[model samples]
Target: MAIPVTAIFDIGKTNKKFFLFDENLRELHHEYFKLTPTLDDDGFECDDIYVLCNWIQNTVRKITSSGEYQLKRLNFSTYGATLVHLDADGKPVTPLYNYLKPFPDDICDQFYKQYPQDEHNLHTASPALGMLNAGLQLYWLKYTKPQVFQRIRYTLHFPQYLSYLFTGQLVSEPTSIGCHTKLWDFSRNRYHDWVYTEKIDHLLPEIVPASKTFQTIIGGHAVKVGVGIHDSSSALAAYMMRTQEPFALISTGTWSITLNPYTKESLTRDELNRDCLNFLTIEGKPVKASRLFLGHELDHHLRILNDIFHKEARYYKQIKLQDSFLKKIHNHELTPSFYPATIANPLLSQDVFSSDNWKPNNFESYEEAYHHLIWGLTLLQVASARLALGNSDVKKIYIDGGFIDNDIFIKLLQYYLPNYTIEVSHMPLGSAHGAAMIMQGKQVELVV
Candidate 1:
């Protein structure tokens, strides 16, 4: 008998990736494809459902027929805050709306007026973050696009939608439902009453546990399809399998999110305003997390330096600026106290002058100039991480993602956060690996 293999469809906004892992959670093969957005009849930007559906079908067929591996189970881990509407026939009735689409202003006003900001915040345990709140998207469609809304038979979160593509079943999983979607009542541990009160409960698919499994046959192979999980939560699951002690994870990428799985306290308004939010674990528990736009800012500043000095940004090596230069840049008139610690503002001239902005006017080497830039970026990241730490008893900070490869950034972070022991995670495929691990009732061994 052949060993059982699990296939994971890890879907992101830009890339749709597939991975096949054996029963021991070892990756066998992986493939990825980019998805293009298509305009709907009204010229609104939406995902090409047909393209995604066809790709998934073709990939599954090809993988199952390879004869190199026997497929036994399948699972999905995808980005959150997007939904797909299915018709009575289990077919998508409308274009998968992009979460990037703006929410209507009138609806926002009406929603706040009806529920009051504080009441709604307390009820949902979610901050009002423009389009990031998936529940608001449903409200937008109901009020602004009634025609499309009326035709919907069921709505599934993005990960669940991917699972539905293969299982031919519409089910909502906890990980997707519990994201900052404002759909689930975290305090009550059930769907919010507004779902039924607003008559939109019919749109929701049947709820299922994240670890629940369903049987499906594909290409003469019997496969167990597990309910989907959110990518962040999946990553956490993979990490938890390796460690039993309380620890915090800094998942770095476009956004550096510091997650404290042990912090179960409800978020206050100030924390929400600072970009802190709750994530639902695969087991349907709230995981407190705070996000910082460090990666975005770093790239922005690097590009600005590249343009100004006509040099590509070097990230791997450490750059140390002279004490005099650092002092001068810190005291420079261009530096603003309120300069947002985010990469949203790229123009160095508009914010603070770092080593990146230091031309040969007085500096001796390019290394010095680069060091200044690193100093500023590192300082911002440290401050952001401290804010995310809050009052949580985070003993060890596990850094993962692109920044872990940068020695200069890590060293600077180590210097600033001297109180906590910093460790870089070796897990390469975190979220996808976590999804695969959860399916087999196994855990990832932590590498120190």
Candidate 2:
């Protein structure tokens, strides 16, 4: 007799991981690896498609052939805002282009002008993210990389492409397509009309429920493979599956995303401008979401802190959150200008960063200055989280992801969201857990 376990591959821009989960969703074994990226045919940097595919096959083959455990199921959870173009031979015809690649301004301008942005963007519940919208990548390819576009017999989001590798089946899952991709018309509950107008919809494979799985033959054994899900939705799925009531999940990482499954109204123009959008649940339900570059900003701010204070990197680990500082934050007495105006990124405007009179020079110590910066950050976080809290019944806010371990951050969040129940969820591999959760059933059970 062999031990049975579910195998999951969680793919991200910087890390590729494989995990084995026992029957109760506990991690049995895991492995992490990094594959160096290479330039595409156009000489632009991108993930090497062949190398990634080869690694996936060889690793899974080795795992199953070892006889340590029986591979009961297979699933994938990957970052969004990426597409994989496959030719008629069911193989990649183009590089797995980076979402951050510079999209031509003219191409973006043309796309907005061709469609009524106020109506279309609001209806789609997506912001004007240019190529970051993913669907816009098709339009860019159509006009800029016509040869590559012509060779595409099918276009699959990154997660689906990974699933196709094992199941040899292509699918369009709502959780992946409904992310701020600008492809699905939330109001219409299908691909936007412009997709048909441009005939791009033809290349899309059939839309399948994110909860659906199919049989696949691998390593001379039958396997259950999921259709794939967007990483955000997959992470949300774990909470959604376990909880039986309305709640908001604030996932903090490079980007801090707040997802609310109970929002009642459609997104307005203001929400879109503020980076508020909709994410389809694993059950194909709309989840109001808002994003902020909280963690990234924290990193950049810390780097500057290290340089200014002449301290070692990651010195934050040594400093402890003080009760006095927490009280100052609670009373709104810790007003100070931090994050020099020169450090402004696209995520948050620095015009509102207040006066720079309280720079590091003003503080007696680096620890005090860093705490003040976080105090200001908490205020911004409350505002960002509120965007996703619109018209929802959620009273409990669950904080998870990279920053959950920060006692000061959690304390600040609790202070700000005093009206809501705040709790820190130590589980960080939410996306992987979610992929496994969706494996046992097709339609997710929603608590009324």
Candidate 3:
């Protein structure tokens, strides 16, 4: 008898990964592949959906025919803020538009002008993120590209679309819909009024729980396929399962998202302006989340510093957390000298951090300068994390992903959030693991 296994496709903006886990949920094999993106109709670079679809189908056939392990289940965890519009015949009507594609300013201004209430944002728990709001993408299509909009019969978030390819199920999950898509009304537990007013909700499929699964045939083998989940919410689900205490998670990557699922406070306008939003759990409960482009900023600054300091790439990885450096930063004896006034804003621009300002002669050593950068970022992180925490009594803070290896980032976070117990999570479970776990009827308990 072969070992029973589950396969998970963890798709990101850049890397696409496939993982197989045994009956006990231990990772057995993993493969990482990068897909080349193609330009959208607007010439903005976007995912080549045809390539992705073929890769997924080919991988499934290859796995099921191997006869090494019995493929029992399949699921997906992909980035949010992207949608796939389907024609009446269930074919893609438009390119998989990149979330980073700049939404037209005219369209954005027009939207707010028509719906001037700040309460609109609060109710949906979605800020003015332009193209990042999937619902706005539909709105953009309706007004700007009415021809394309007219041909659409259904709209599916990226993850569910991937699931649809195999299961033939057209459904939406809360985790994807609730990810600052400007579609879900978090307060009312339904589509926002604007969604109906615009008739964009008419294109969306029936809502389903993230864990909902359907039996399907693949390469002559029977498999259970999940409805799929948003990557960030999927990650939080992993931590939610291991601990029973009231805790907060800082999932660090290109974006450092601090999530507090326990906060009871209502979403506020001020929080929206400060880049705070809500992500939904698998069961459709809102999780307060605050985000920062921390990793992007950190890497951007590091590249400039590396050239100035004449150090090899990743030299900052060798630097340890120095108490003397940390103390001066904490005491304000040494300010975040390298940062400009625009540091107050979480959004980044080329002019905000000019490489000319980062002179090597200004610092005693690379370590000192690096520590200052981490200190500054940690301060911002503390502030962002606090927004997610709000009035919640969560005392435990778990740091996961890229920043886990950065000693300075971890220590500085600990210094700033002293009241909370901050620790690095070594758990192997990530978004992919969480998606697989969901298919097994597992629920993450948060009661302490």
The candidate maximizing lDDT is: 3
lDDT of 1 at 429: 59
Can you write out model 3's per-residue Cα lDDT over 345-398, one digit (the tens) per residue? 634223223342545458877787787778667767887898899999899988
Residues 1-448 of candidate 1: C-alpha lDDT, one tens digit per residue: 5556888988765557899888778777899888888986567797798998798889889878887778888898887888888877878777777766767788989888876877676667777765678978788778878988888888888888878877888888777876779887767877778777788888887776777777899889888887788887787778887789888888776667677788747777766655677777766677787666667666765675566566755742455434564455447523422234444323322323333433333434455545655666666666556555677787798888667877667776776688999988776457788888878864222110
Top-down lDDT ranking: 3, 2, 1
Which model, 1 or 3, shows the larger lDDT?
A: 3
Q: Over the stretch 1-448, how does candidate 2's per-residue lDDT look in tens digits?
A: 6778888888866678888888778889889878898987767788887898888889889878989888878999988899999998987888888876778999988888899788889878998876679999899899988998899999999999999998888788888888889998888777889999999998999887787788988888898988888887888988977889889999777667899988898888878888889988876778899987787678777887788888898788767689988776568686656643322333443434556564665678888878877766676677789889986788999887778777777887887788999878876477888898888563653211
TM-score of 2: 0.92
lDDT, residue 165, model 3: 98
Arrange candidates, best TM-score first.
2, 3, 1
**Each prediction's whole-model lDDT (CA):** 0.72, 0.81, 0.84
Q: Which ten-residue region of model 1 has the weakest summed lDDT? A: 345-354
Q: Per-residue lDDT for 347 in model 1?
A: 30
In model 2, which range of ten residues has the least summed lDDT? 340-349
RMSD of 2: 2.8
